[model samples]
Target chain A: GGIITQTPKFLIGQEGQKLTLKCQQNFNHDTMYWYRQDSGKGLRLIYYSITENDLQKGDLSEGYDASREKKSSFSLTVTSAQKNEMAVFLCASSIWDNYAEQFFGPGTRLTVL
Target chain B: GDQVEQSPSALSLHEGTSSALRCNFTTTTRSVQWFRQNSRGSLINLFYLASGTKENGRLKSAFDSKELYSTLHIRDAQLEDSGTYFCAAGNNAGAKLTFGGGTRLTVRP
Candidate 1:
């Protein structure tokens, strides 16, 4: 069984600061996704990639930028952190089709001060 | 306008009890997936159903595209079953999923 690993389990950022979160998967899946989850709420998709160097925007993609540098890694960048914001960012990977189950990372908790 | 409506925001159960969680989709969904997020915030995939029902161990899940609903049933609950459960639906083959609000389950001894 392959695992998805996310860097920086916790993050603290100031207003207007830029922060980046990274994800890696060894499942050799062709699809990767980024999602945001607020406290006590469901997850909203931000971006997804079908293949290396390919990107697609999701419902919550406006405030974020994503990069699929290669097949095994996907990264998300918060352009400008919002003040007093708190959320968790999750990464997932799937095997080239929607019918397959997606495996997720533990998540990175972001706190903006 | 959320695409998925999940019921029972929270639940508490004894170790030997049983219960079920559900998700209703607002649109036509091509597939449904169930996941349980543990205390450490790691999501573990439970089931992925395009249609019909699937069972594994003490858990069973069913999805009906025509009915636009899905259910996950857990019998003989254990302390390890305490976690937040979420159901996600996808309308197309794009692999983008709309997640339910989640049901936080607390199993007590």
Candidate 2:
């Protein structure tokens, strides 16, 4: 069994600051995803990568950028933090198969002050 | 756009009781996944199904692609089971999972 690791379990940044979250997976999955979950709500996908150097925008990708330089790692950058924003960013990975289950990391909680 | 709608935004159950949560899809879904978010904010994958039903211990899940719905049943609930559950639907391979609003389940003794 492989695990997904996300850095900086908690983050605090100023308004308009750029914060980056990193994720790495050893499952060798071909697909990686970034999702944001607001308090008391479900997750909304921000970006996903199907392969190395490939990216796909999701419903909530407007304020975020993603990079997938290595097959085992994916990173997300908050282009500009919004004031008083609080959310948890989750990273997940899965194989290319339609039936494959996506495994998630512990998540990074971000707070913009 | 494809959407996943989960019913009963919140639920309460007693120990040893049984309950079920459901998800209804707006479009044809090729697969469905169920996850439970623990208190520490970690998502635990419970079930992944393309079709039919699957049982593991006290939890059972069913997915009907033709019917565009899925259900998760919990038998003999426990305190550890109190958490937020989410169901995600996918139409294509390797990308784009539409998640439901989530069902918060609290198992009280």
TM-scores, in order shown? 0.97, 0.97
What CAPRI-style quality would you assign to candidate 1? medium
Model 1 whole-model lDDT (C-alpha atoms): 0.94
Docking class of 2: medium
i-RMS, each model, one decimal: 1.2, 1.6
Clashes of each: 0, 0
- Model 2: residue B18 alpha-carbon error in angstroms: 0.4
CA shift of A59, model 2, Å:
1.2
Off by over 4 Å in 1: none
DockQ scores of all models, one per candidate: 0.80, 0.69
